[model samples]
Target: MPSDVSRSSARPGGSATDLAAVWAVFTDMYEAYLAGDRARIDAHLDPEATVWDSATPQLLLGKPALDQVRAQRPAAERAGGGPVEAGLTAYDQVIDVFGELAVCRHWLRIDYRDRPSGLLRNTAVLRRAHGGWLITHLHEDGQAAD
Candidate 1:
């Protein structure tokens, strides 16, 4: 069984709608994070996905890494907390709608803890496989203030 119930496959379809569905998954992940819903965030992301940041000194790989991060949250604040709030400054996204191969570039400004208070740009590539869209790779590099 998957570590969390939310991580289980929620949808099963391979069509044009998958594009929007997959994108919704990404968006939901962000929203869930801001809401301090760690299970929801993990559910939306692939188990093999990697998280990285240009400013951070390490790369977080797979659900285990993400789970570890979530585990650090205090029990009282794990579900919903003021610190979970983040302002999304910008979202410049580009999506290539190929039948099987797609790439999405999301430029964002996040206010997570222990991070600078500026924009942090990121890119993600997704592939349609096994009747679903899976995030194959992602890279995020921070930009210092001018």
Candidate 2:
């Protein structure tokens, strides 16, 4: 039911250009998080989107919910005793575009305190909203395979 050309265009790694915008925004988000820039994170994330892939698996929906996440950053930092230094080891991202909807799968290796030596793979789905993109849903799993 689909033409070959269409199929080709829809492939995950179809064209580098096709994924540039989303990837840039996603990268920006990651940088903001790393820098502990709550304002920047809030600015990019949709008010109604949900962040589901945390250790607590939070369902952060609506502006208030997102703001709560922003608020929790400092508290979490305090709880953890200090700032976390994380470095990405591997990132294999796949972006699927369907008009204004996009889904991204990011396999990342994060260095955190609890598991300072293992890699965790996180998958996040984003959507285009209000002239920008926002993370709509996320699911992360800790992997020992690394």
Candidate 3:
């Protein structure tokens, strides 16, 4: 909800705990995207962040690139409508935290427009910055749904 991520006691210690913490941040970022809250999304991303998605061949690097992509999208898609629904069901999630850096790998099921559009294999790299974890790099490959 807020730009800042909240930590819970339920998330305990060790890799699992760390993973949960990072996952919370990730979900928050995703929610911001869905809500079209550019400020909130910016808060969760590093200035040098890069992302690759199935729809694009060019790597999206930096906030300007992200903005351009968003501007190119249809207003309805950006604003959200038409029975649109998306979910990220992550499996085989692995998070490795080293000092201030963390890498997460997971298989994700992405449902779009109320249908199972695709399965995505994702790897995200985060860095502890600006008082919280911010996504620095994200790579995704979309595959045919089962």
* Per-model TM values vs. the true structure: 0.62, 0.70, 0.75
1-146: candidate 3 lDDT, tens digit per residue: 22222322222233555657777676676677666677987887888899896667889999889778878877776667544756545556666777678886667666676665678888889998765688899898887888
Model 2 pairs in collision: none
Query: Model 3 Cα displacement at 49 (Å)?
Result: 0.4
TM-score leader: 3
Top-down TM-score ranking: 3, 2, 1
Error of 3 at 9 (Å): 19
Residues 20-130 of candidate 1 have per-residue lDDT tens digits of 555665676676756657677666557888877453457778878756765775776665553543555435555565667666666566665644566667777677767
Q: Which rank order by lDDT, best down to worst?
A: 3, 2, 1
Q: Cα lDDT for residue 78, model 1?
A: 68
lDDT per residue as tens, model 2, 1-146: 11112222235443554466666665676677677676787676666666664554666666777566656666756465664656544356667877777776665566665556555666666777776677776666767744
Cα RMSD to native, each candidate? 8.9, 6.7, 5.3
After superposition, candidate 3 runs with Cα above 4 Å error: 1-17, 79-83
